[model samples]
Target chain A: MRTSIIGIYEDEKVLMDAFNRLQSEGITIADVLSPIPLHGVWEKLKLTTRLPLATFLYGAFGAIATFGFLYWTSVVSYPLKFGGKPLNTLSFIIIMFVLTINIGTLFTFITYFIREKMYPGKKVELAVPRTTDDQFTIVIERPHNMSAEEQKKINTLLKETGAVDIIESNN
Target chain B: MYNTRVRGILIKGNKSFSDVSRDIIKPMDDKTPLWWYISAFIASALLIWGVWGFYNTITVGIGTWGLNNNVAWGWAIINFVWWIGIGHAGTAFSIFLLIVRQKWRTSINRAAEAMTIFAVMAAGLFPLIHMGRIWDGFFIFPYWNTRGPLWDNFNSPLFWDVVAISTYFMASFVFWYIGMIPDFATIRERTASAVKKKIYGVLSFGWIGNAKGWLRFETAAILLGGMAAPLVVSVHSIVSMDFAVSVVPGWHTTIFPPYFVVGAIFSGFGMVLTLMIVMRKLYRFKDYVTDGHLDAIARILTFMSLIMGTAYLTELFMAWYSGSEYELFTFMKNRVTGEYKFAYWTMLICNGMIPQLFWFKAIRKNITIVFIISIFINIGMWFERYVIVVTSLSRDFLPSSWATYEPTITEIAVYSGTMGLFILGVLMFFRFVPTIAISEVKGVLKETSTLKSFTDEN
Candidate 1:
């Protein structure tokens, strides 16, 4: 069995301080949850994301595909003379640009949901219910075989670093 | 971050994170207000009237409208452009302010975005109903149909309008919904009702608010905002191209794109001002949407009004300088002094001149005065479109085509119905959602002067 320890704080700064102190003491933080995004918390967690790159890639593909469709339809498939305007022209750029945004936005939206393992009606079990309101929660998981002394030291550290409450559970 | 000393405190009254959430969610949690019922009843009545107009339009056909042979595009197109211009407000408010890092937008953006979605919905109805055969609307799309040579003219500005408006509507919806997820999650955690909790939970998409989620959320917001900024510009520009691409004397001008864009922003800000003023008063959002925020929007309008004035003058100058008799007749004769002179002058005073009152600090701070002026700006912008659409088309090159246009009862009903729909959408939004973005307000709470010491310690 693994034990999960949750430290709850009221202020984001105190949470950040507790987070930094735990890391310095060689404790691994499973996650930090808050109502609003904490400044520098993602960086502190050393998490890297390529969502921007994904958006760009999606946008490029959309632009190319949109342009190709426009060209094939207007130039190759069914070319009609539009008041002496060329069969293929820059008018396609507007449609291409708009479609690219639609694709990039929609694809990135789906990507974010998939990456986060989130969906409508997904049952969420918050470690601290108030984590979505005014509270900040820091979750740490450790083996149940860890000594009581080590657990007490971690609890004391959290309490001293401004954690209002600490709860331990085993799964 | 820049010094907070330079800007007014975004959220007033030294708000805490819990306070922000409680204050915002209180409206949602409390019993429905009576004023809402009254307003909603009025809006529904208007909507019913509008539905009658639409029924007549669909059943009776385009003949019910006031459109003549020469003035084929009357109130339908004019109202379409006007509503589309108004739709620009929410994105303009949220995306532009987000890019520029204006913290003041947090309180007002939710309402503005809701307004945008509703306004766009209303705007879209005109073009569909104006088609006379609403079922044939799918023909606007570029699909592989059996009609061998008719694949939705990829070169027509009208087709561009369809694609651009649809994409814009979808993009704005995505951006608005994405921004609301965290707020919805907050509502889910706070609501006492089990059913409400379940609904908000589903709406929130099980958002956990972990660092990784915020990381991706912020990245996605910026990406969407950057793309949407240009999309908003293109949407209106394409709508303007629907006119400028034509050879009509008043319509055919190289200046239409920029002129239309500036006019759109000006009118959008005008409508935002009107909605926010009423909202702030009704919802008692004085603490969140402070006077400074309204003043900022007014300042933007004042500046845009100047550009509008300049654009109007530029059009006049171009007409005289181009040495085209038709252009001169359209500008100086038909618009400036002819039968449509009332509309022309209404546009001039409402759009080009009325907003100049905001240059005074006293007037900008006065809520009643500001609200009235905002209404005038909206009316003025409508007249601006009217002058562009009706005045030009009513008196083309041939004197035989010179015939005045007036909207029939059906056209008037459809227009008012859209207003009713817009109001009802906003009222429901207020009743259900947190009018002020709770999380965003909480996020900015630390930046206020009262909390300056708190941030300094961090």
Candidate 2:
């Protein structure tokens, strides 16, 4: 969305090093993209993620609500007995447990998709086409307060850390 | 720490991430193979025939099948249990293996998961046909009827089955789709056609391979896997309850739940072996689906066969020890030396004795033998369900009403039709989706230090 220096690296190791170096030097990196997910990159960038926490909460809520709903339906709404079984049975517990898991799993996945803004028909602009294949890319949005010397230093650092190509894009 | 080689090298030939992507994505991009189309054509023909059989059954009434008042649960129930059993291996491979930290599952999990979805579809068909009045099949659901305001009996195992099975299908579908997202994104990047790209893009949901996204993806997979692992056990257990809850002597075993679960995994691995052996050969995925994967599956199948064999013997021992006349009659008289003794003995040999061949290293490693054994196991599992359902029901407490059961042409056609539908689903899946999870395969490739060393040497 803003003018950014996009650095493309052929290898994940070099891209990670350059990304950490830039983060350490106090440069605000817009994002790093790679063919495969690079784990620990968020911790390396010192960014806190709430996705896992959100998933857990969503699952818990779903399980509780599903169990409650099953209880209300079987006990409160319609108290019909079959084969002289009690109002509540151990078999209902198994059904309730499975429903909780089913509902919880579906809810967690849906919430993850929604929170991540991942949905059908969303257009994604690839900064580097090869980022989805065999390359890793780092995008650094230029700060208005940065001096020319600092910009030059960042460019040299990216090149030294094995960036095969550097492109300044307005995309 | 170096025990990654315990299962042998998952991927061979020093394949890099790019290599993995290319190999997986090639089938998607390339023209459909002649064999694929030929197989699809034959499957389609059989599916059409099965549909006609189903139509005839519905029109001609329940009398169309070999089912009677006594043998009410016939081929339909048998096929239902058989399909459900076949579906279990996929979930077991994906979820149980993931929980246990078996990384090699990544290579074959996608296709196996797809098989689960299709097998469940096949399983769902039998109950519908068995209903006879399938138009009123919605009665199985919990929704309030607009006409008579009928309410479903939640206490019924059949009702629980309706809930469990649909839940199982939806859960497996979501889990499969979620796992496919990143790989679909890769396909989006690799494709040349705009239409294909757009389709894959939407399916991928704008995956950017960001750190946060990856973390969420991994977390979600684990969560879904954890939920699915239990479901894989429970769905089959509930299916087993359809029999166990009944007072039928042979069907009312306390061991049905765990026994069914183990048999499901055993037969499931058998189906997986049957499919994967052919798939690896056809797709040339020897490097990814390597001998280690086959060996591991064989070992599990062997273990399951032994468990199943023990369960079979336990039924006999229970029958004799309980001294219940009916139970003893079902096992000793009806099953062992009864009219259907041939079917009983075949089940014993196919499901029990045949898988024991895998105990030998050479047989486990032999693709041809594994394939043949897997086919026999599938047949054996089918007969096992038949023996349980028909044998127990055909000769119940009353000796006056005893009659031998045989499946009619319509029933056989419908069963054959489901086979066609299943093969068609697998064929379509192979042509379209990435049969192997490319990203996960790449992840495993990165984790394998042995591969890293090999690449380093090169």
Candidate 3:
């Protein structure tokens, strides 16, 4: 069984303070769950994301693909004269621009879901209840071999840093 | 660390995170209110009446409408444009305010976006039903087929409208749904009933508000917002092109794109004001949808109303300056002094004149007066479309082709139905969904709260 140590915080500022103190004490945090997104939490946790870059690439692909499709259908496949205007034209730009947004947003949303392992009907095992409401929780993996004295010390530190409660769970 | 010098408190009451959740989610937990049932009943009645109209339209064909050869496009087109303009408010409110980093948008954006979705859905019905043969609507799509594999006219502005509206609808829905996920997760955790929890769980897509998820979520929001910003402008511009591309005297103009976009945002803000005021009053959400928020919207409408006025005058000037007889007749004679002058003046008063009342601080502060003005703006915008469509088509280049237009009972019924549909959708949203975005309101609470120091220390 794996053990986890959780510190429940009512306030975000206190949570941030406790997070920094835990880092200074050379403790590794497994994750922080928050009701609302805590400012600067990602940077504090040394997390980086490439979702923006992915969205840009998706958008570029959509633009190119849309333009090519419009050109092929209008100019190459079934070219027809309308009021003597050119068959291959810039009128497709608006459609291409719209489709780029549509494709980019749809793909990025899917990527987010896949990366996060999220889908409809997926069971949610919350780290701590009400973390989605008003609470912030700091989770740390408790080493199996850690002495009782060390565990008590960690609990005391959390209390000093204004954690409203400390919970240890094994699953 | 809000500078009080610049703006009022966004979330009026000093609310803790738990308090924010409790306040926002309270409505969903409580018994259905009497007003909701009353409103829903009225909306359903209107919807049923509208269905009868639609049934007549589909059965009797396009001949059932007030449409003649001269004024082929009447109330259906007018209502479509009006509803679309109303639809612009949600994305415009959320995305533009988001890009500008307006913290106040947090309290109101969710409801506004919901309004957008419903309004767009309502607007979309017009073009489809207006086709006279709704089943043949697929002919507008550019797809492969055995019949010469004939593609839709890619060069047509009408085709662009199809692409634009669908893209706008899909993008707005995605953006709105993405914003709602974290909030849904909150509701999932808060609700007592097992069924509610399970339903919200699926709706939330099992969101767990981890640090990484929040980061990605915020980043995606910005990305989507960036992309959708241009969409908010493009959708209505394309809608405007449906008219502007035609060589009809008042229809053909280079000013249509920007003018339509501005008009869209103008009317959209008006609708948002109306809806938000109602929501604020009915839900007792004064702390979240504070007077300050309404003030900010009124100011925006004031500015937009000025631009609308300028666009109107510029149209007149262009018609006269270009020395085109047809343009002059459309602007000076047909619309201004001719049969549609009532609609023209009504549009001017409601859209161009009434919103200017916001310049007075007292007027903007009064919620009732503001609400009435919003309704007037809605009416005025409808008339604006009517004047543009009817006047331009009714008396064009040739007198023989000219004919006056009046909406049949069926046409009016279909419009009433859309109104019913719009109201019904909003009512359902209120009853089921969290009217205010719980997570987003909490996210801004620290910065905008009056008791910031208290929250920080707690």
Candidate 4:
């Protein structure tokens, strides 16, 4: 039988408990969840990338789309003329350029949604629901072949580490 | 010890969480007074009707309002200058906050930025509306043509206006939205209804308060604010161009650009004080807005009043030194003995006389008094517009063609109705958007106490 790991934590205290239990019990952890980020979770998970690249790419992409779309619309198609003037007025292009910047930069907001994987109508399981305002989550996996005694020790450690509720799910 | 010192300064205004909740949500009920709904609906209705009126104004010709070859622009142009002048506060507020390094800017920026957008909307409408032939408005732009197309004269001020206003509006929108993301997350998490939660969640874009996100947010904000400061100044100077580029006696001056910009700020600060004063009382945000904000605004008023005073003096000096009879007569008779001389002197006293009182510590510090003083400044600034437009148009190069400028009844209705629209937009905005930035103020308050900092909320 495979078991999933779940911890109910209100504060950083239980987050610490989950970490210690995960380490001490050697429970091939399925996953750990909390409402907030625990202090050393990145060290625990071993994440090694920066988000600056993601932000930069999304923002620059927005600016370009803005300029390209307007230039095509005003300069290329249906250029307006008045007072014996040409259809494509360079002065009017300022508004077009500005519209692009506003629209383009605004579109980068979609990137954040994609990066978070939190979209409308799709709900993620509450690793710890309080993560919205407070508390952090740390998820670890428990392997399939853990002995019952080993499982009991992990449970005991979880209780001692301040996990409000420790659940082993049947995966 | 530090906590005690901070607490000591915290003037305990008696308000609870529910009072805040109730005070903010006071008008939310369907049992809302008949007058409130009636007023908003009627104003909104007139606004809708006014759109048609404006449509006629454009379609029928520039002849819809009082315009002749001598005075090609009237109410539309006047209101355009007024509304654009009004748009100054949003970028100005952001700049002032950035320069002073005010952390509380987060609490107030959203509401103020909305002012920028709405005012810009009203301002932009005037120019388009004044163009009369709506379809042909694009001719104002300088573009390449099929037949040696005549471009817009870059030297013309209107071109400059087009550049400045668009830049300011775009920068303001980006700056305003970026600031809202974090707060949107808070609303998303706290909102009870699934629909609201979902809406806020979508708007928030999964902004988890990671350290990395905060750094980039800061960088983007600083960059936007930096762009906006000079942009805001440029925008007004461009609006000034529509007047300064002209050959009219009072209008033909190099000093008009900087003078108009200063007057815009002077007027903008007054409007900010006027709104905030009421807003603080209505929403019980007295503590958040603080006397400090009002005081800062007052100091700005004093400085700008002096600048405007100098601009007035400089104009008079230049007109005399140039030795032009018409220009000299316009300045001397304009304020001293012209038919519109009352308006001119009223502007002088209101913009100059009232703000001089702010140089003192006592008057500027008092909210009730400062609010009154700001109203005077607003009147002065509006009259300042009137003086510029009416005085010049009423008297020009040829004495035989000179006629007094009078706004038609339709112009009066539309102008009054535009004010109605402005108020309606502001009232609706205050309702839909959280008027005060909830998270930002909470952030300030959090420093006061040890937050439980964690919860199993779900």
What's the TM-score of each model vs. the native? 0.97, 0.95, 0.97, 0.74
Question: Which whole-number lDDT from 0 to 100 does residue A75 have in model 2?
Answer: 73
TM-score of the second chain in each model?
0.96, 0.96, 0.96, 0.87
For residues B1-458, what per-residue lDDT tens digits would candidate 4 score against the true structure? Answer: 00111221111244333233334344332244555577688878778767766766766766667776566667778777787777788778766666556654544566777787788877777777676677887787656676445444543557667766766777777777767766566556655668877776777666655433444455455555654676666677767777886788989899987998888877877887888887777666765676656776788789999999998889889989999988887878865577888989998999988899998888877778998998998889888888888777777888898777677766765676677787788778666566665434433443323322111110
With candidate 2 superimposed using the best TM-score fit, by how many Å does residue B270's alpha carbon deviate from the native? Answer: 0.7
The fraction of reference interface contacts (C-alpha pairs within 8 A across chains A and B) present in each candidate is 0.77, 0.55, 0.79, 0.09
Q: What tens digits encode model 3's per-residue C-alpha lDDT throughout A1-171?
A: 889999999989999999999888988888899988765678778888899899999999999999999988888888877767788887888889889998998898889889888999788878586899889999888988988987887898899999999998773
Winner on DockQ between 2 and 4 is 2
- The 10-residue segment of model 1 chain B with minimum total lDDT is B449-458
2 or 3, which is superior by lDDT? 3
Kindly list the per-residue Cα lDDT of model 2 for residues A39-147, writing each as its tens digit: 6576675656565576567667766776676666667777777788876666666667677777777788888888788998677877786777788888888867878
Flag regions of model 3 displaced more than 4 Å: B1-6, B450-458
Question: Ten residues in a row with the worst lDDT in model 3 chain A?
Answer: A35-44
Instruction: Please tell me which predicted candidate would have the highest DockQ against the true structure.
Output: 1
How would you encode candidate 4's per-residue C-alpha lDDT over A99-129 as one tens digit per residue?
4344434444444445445454443334344
| lDDT tens digits, residue span B1-458, model 2 | 11133234578878877888999999888889999999999999999989988998999878999987789989999999999999988888788988888877888899889999999999999998899998988777777656444456667889888878888888888889999998888889888899999999989899878766776777778878888889988999999999999999999989999999999988888999999999999999998887778888888889999999999999999999998999999999999997989899999999999999999988976889999999999999999998999999999988888888999999999998999999999999999899999888877675563643321232
- Could you say which candidate leads in lDDT? 3
Cα lDDT tens digits for candidate 1, B43-85: 9999999999999999999999999988999999999999999
Q: What's model 1's overall lDDT?
A: 0.88
User: Comparing candidate 2 with candidate 3, which one achieves the higher TM-score?
Assistant: 3
